[model samples]
Target: MEKNEKNEEEEADEEFEEDYEIKILHGYENNYYDISKPFFIYSKENLVNFEILDSILPMNTSKNEHKSGIIECRYQLSCFLRLTRDVTEVTNNLNIQQFKYILMTLKFLKAVENKNITKLLQVLIFNNFFYQKDYKLRNYNLHLIQILNSSFFTQIDFHLKKNIMSSFLNSLMIRYDFYDENLIIFKNSKELFDYSMFSEHIPYKNLMINNFDAFCSVENILRDSNVLIIFQILLKEINIKSLILNNFFRHLNPDENFAFLISKIEIFKAFTISNYKIPASPFFLFCLIVSINNNIEYLRLENISYCRLNLRGLLEGKKLKGLILSKIGLTENASLINESRNVYETIEYIDIQGVFLNHSIWHEIFQSTNSSKIILHFNNSDIEEIFINNLKKFEIQKNSVLYLEIKFNSNTLPRGFCNSLIHFKNLKTLKLDGYIIYEDTESLLYKAIYYMKELECLVLCQNCRNTKPYIFLLQNSKIDCLDIQSTSNNNDAIMIEFFRLHKSMTRISIKDAKVSSLCLKEIFKQKNLIHLCLDIDILPPQVDQESLTFKSKNIHNLDLCNNTLKYIEGVDILSKLYRVHTLRISKCNPPPGYLSKLNKKCNSYVKILTYEYGILDFDDLNRIGKLGNLLKLNLLGCKFSGCSFFDLVTSCKFFKSLKTINLLNSNIKMKDFQCMKRFKKLKRAVFSFTEFNLLTLKNSLASLQICKLKFHTMLEDSNYNEFCLYLNESNIYILRG
Candidate 1:
């Protein structure tokens, strides 16, 4: 027995010595340890010791107690002493591992001393502990609280201490209700004694209210009349459960009449009634109610069945900041005169959709507000008459409005409206939604374009069957951004001419428009164009190829979607666009070695290259590997099957600069992603489909420290529970699995 005791004692000593060596080694090398290294090393080595210590610690009397009483007691005591010493050393080391150790020890100690630990541990638990090296250590508060019961806490005033109070407040802001009920107990303890604690906890009611008294304390905070009234409004807006509502009402005692007035406002009723004339459904009414209760200012009245607003009484109000009246059937002489006269000075945003505003109403509006931004939707109005009558009125008040949106449904714009636009010299952003330029009005459009020289952005959607007017506008406009969607065919020459004339255009989009080789050649000559989108039916036979041979490469984002191109040569043209970063080719078939040649030519400058809605076989992956500086590669809706794509991604060690790899809606597997960890600089990864298990992917990605991670599954059989577990374990930002 004595011999056995001596052996056990020696073993304990050796264990203690090993722990001491580990603590000393960690302390000495703490400064040198790199935080960017994978966390698995620390988890395996350091956490294993903690687990072993937890096993040996005793909390209750048991059947095995007598069988190994003396040995177990000594072993437990020695292990505790070793852990305590190690924790102290780690805390002194001031590294990520030390911080993690401190948190882990606190958790273990709290668990062991449940209902017995002193108040100091509780206070320590509330304090903001910074690892300085490990960002993950910030989320350890819930775990600490979970292990310690409320009995361990003392009646110390939390608000009086300002050192780590902010940190404690932030901690209370997070949800902690898991399998354990100790968080509930702690919250209830705070509520039962201290009214001051209620103030700090009210802002985070969604986080804490698992226990009984916690709800009442939150109600008390809400009942405080001196507090910001916005809090009450926000509380009502949040979809609190019926149980919570009942608890709130039970403890709520309002001294002032404001809360009572707010309660009596019948927020839901007001919302439903206000939108009744606007043809909104009950669901929409609820949304509006929630928005209004939350004081959300930005409201869109699109497609709402609105008649003339009964604004005869609205003339009394002083501040009418945001007003949206889109798709409302207000006549030319709607009862907006009084309202416009009263709050027009205060109104900042005015949206008039499909409303017939005659000359007099326009005159009144222009005369009323000096700095309001107007969005006029004349989709089904007699725009010509309105424009002719209101042109002089608008010109006189050019300094009043900053932004204008003129949307027309017809293909041809009224000559009068085009003529009137020339009068507004101070227009900042002009969105001409539909193709509204007529052949006859081309001169007027050009004149308006010249007049609005101060215009920053011009959006002209080619909803017209004819593309000539749009071509005219693009060629003449000096606007910074030219977003044109041409619906007509056979306008490639006009577009080429337009770009040739306007070399300083910043962003241009010609979706479903034809562009000839001459047009591309002219476009290439303009190296100042940053963002270019060309959706041509056919690449200008072979002539365009020659033009591309001398391409000027200043383009940053080149989106060639749904273009007709059998082969893409003259990639040498891209060498001239030195700043080109993103290249997108969708629904097009190029020559077999076209992309490969481009990749080889561009080398490290190409950052993003995406191919969607097309066939991308193994050859494509091999070609993609040649772009050394490629950071983001999206292969959505592509026909690349099997493990070849995976192999290509894994083997591209030169793709160390790669940050985002999107393989959504592709035929890939979970196993295909096993080699992703090789990319050390990868920050974001997206995967879709049920075949890729979120839990498996999350576990695999845990070591990557990915900043933005997304997982999407189509199957109803997906394991959301396991996915959430993995998400919680890993510190990934976004989890959509």
Candidate 2:
């Protein structure tokens, strides 16, 4: 009987994941207080002074801390509503541990009842624990069905019903083996779906389903209604990157509403299918193409995100507007030379990250892309031989300009390519990355620029060999901006000369430039140079600290990234620029003390600041709160904790002026509608690659009906019919890659 009991509980453990690790207070007991902690928001009767709380916690408080020996389920109910117990126990004495126990009891109640069950079952499903042995189960004593099914829950709002139902399922998943299988509530649902079939679970991330490839598709669980529930949840998450269909098509029921599924997934406006994966046959490809051929415009193929693959032709369904084809490794021996030529004449943009083709295939690709912008990234040194004769044939499209992003693999470029560039007098922007270049190009590249009077922007990125181009562009081109990368001591002389002619140059950016601290003095001499970015080699870390103080009076924008630094002397020097409105310190981990120096010196003039890939603490938040004119903040990919980031924003006066914010790739919690509730002037926000959740997120955020940013596909719920209707009515622009 004990063995049977263990077996039943093991089965229960298989279906539900264990609870997440509990949160411990960040600071130690003594360190936590004396600082004067605020009272819990829900329990505070009024704003009262806290004489410091106690110094330590009792051990094993994970066990209930209530005065009674057992956990009072009624206490858990109060916390479910975000409420807490009385503050009568606030100890003025530092020695007392009473207040600590008060917090522990509240935490215990919060943990026992606030079981995010849906998330837990997700772990069990993916980890494949049902097939394992000796897994134990723990049960919460509350009868969830009795409480949720009561008249009190029945008359509640429909969304609340869903939440309650979800809570019941979460608890049920963990306690299934412990509960009597013959219990009244263990019967069939209104849809005749049997609960005894096992509890449904959905993953937190987008469902990464694979049969041979999908770990979730085990033992016919694919047919369960839970699969649809997970899909429905994913649709609401708005994380539509790519939905692989390999396992999807293989195990799907023929009678299923695939059309309805397709209709609900209207967020997908781009598609890619590669022949490299599992060797998909032409016949199956044809059927797959026919099924999805109607809606998408942007298409790419193969392992192009990382590598390359075979060129798959556009079929008879939808005409692609932009196509990304990479590493189309066609050989003379291949039979499908004629098969790959299904080009769409209407296509406008083409991006080839890598390509290896003979003359005929190369000609066909260029002919296919007659769009306004064509970008190609190639590492092959022999591209000149492939296009030497053809370069001259390329026309300067009327009213169109040429832009080139050239990286040198060898000093020897096709001798004719740079010579041929001059023929297209319509070249407007030229960006050359010569990190690997050794040969001098100032004569040829500069002479070409001298002739293209239409040239407006010149970016010399990495190993910019000679100074002549900067000096020559002064008279030859209608240039407004110059972005130079990786300057040497020789390039500093080039900059010295360029400054003499940069009175009309409004923007300048130089990265990894090995120049002295005095270069700022020369840079500040240019009256019209409003924006400047420098990655100087600040050696001896505190080079010229006391003597070299920042004093740029007119320069308005500054960026200092990609360099190692030890102090704020450079920023303190640069902060003297009264007009400098945009500042970015990114891709480098400068100490927070360095940031503090910047905040202290330039908080008033700097209107926009972007910091990335660094440790972010409340100090940074507090400093950002001091920037009086800050209009935009892009804190992308920074490591930060605490749920009250936005709460800080609303309370601080300096952050009131913020108009645009990019929190991409960050974990942000707090209601979207409530967090931005105070930023009335806030018009735009970029939250791509972010996961934000709150109690009111789905309801309140979606209800913003007129989310001035015009949320058309913003709510990418998995119902396509409704999405399509919204799309038809929406005039809002949706950006796609």
Best by TM-score: 1
Error of 2 at 542 (Å): 14
What tens digits encode model 1's per-residue C-alpha lDDT throughout 1-737?
00001233344323221221111111122344343652222122232234433443342237553112121222223333333333332222232222233333334332333211222222333333324443223445343332221221211122212212223333334212211111221242112211122221112222223332343344443453322232323223332111111111122133412222222222221111111332323333233233333232223333334234433332333344555554534433445565447666665767666656667666766566654477766665475447545565563456555687766656466576676677677776777776555568766775776666567777767465453434445534666577767645456656666676677777877676655667666655665677877776555364545545434456778777765444234444443556567888777655443454452446666788888766655666676776787877887766664334676765474545677788776766777676677776677777775374665676567656466667677665447666656666555556585
What is each predicted model's overall lDDT from 0 to 1?
0.48, 0.45
Candidate 1 yields a Cα-based lDDT of: 0.48
Tens-digit lDDT string for candidate 2 (4-93): 012222333331222212233422233322224422322223212111111122232455531111112212222222212333322223
**RMSD per prediction, one decimal?**
16.9, 22.2
What lDDT is reached at residue 565 by model 1?
48
Clashing pairs in 1: 413-436, 517-544, 553-576, 553-577, 554-577
Clashing pairs in 2: 210-213, 210-214, 211-214, 263-720, 264-719, 264-720, 327-354, 550-573, 556-580
Candidate 2 regions with alpha-carbon error over 4 angstroms? 1-268, 272-291, 302-312, 315-318, 327-344, 382-390, 393-402, 434-441, 462-464, 467-469, 476-481, 486-507, 512-519, 522-533, 537-593, 600-737
Location of the lowest summed lDDT over 10 successive residues in candidate 1: 240-249
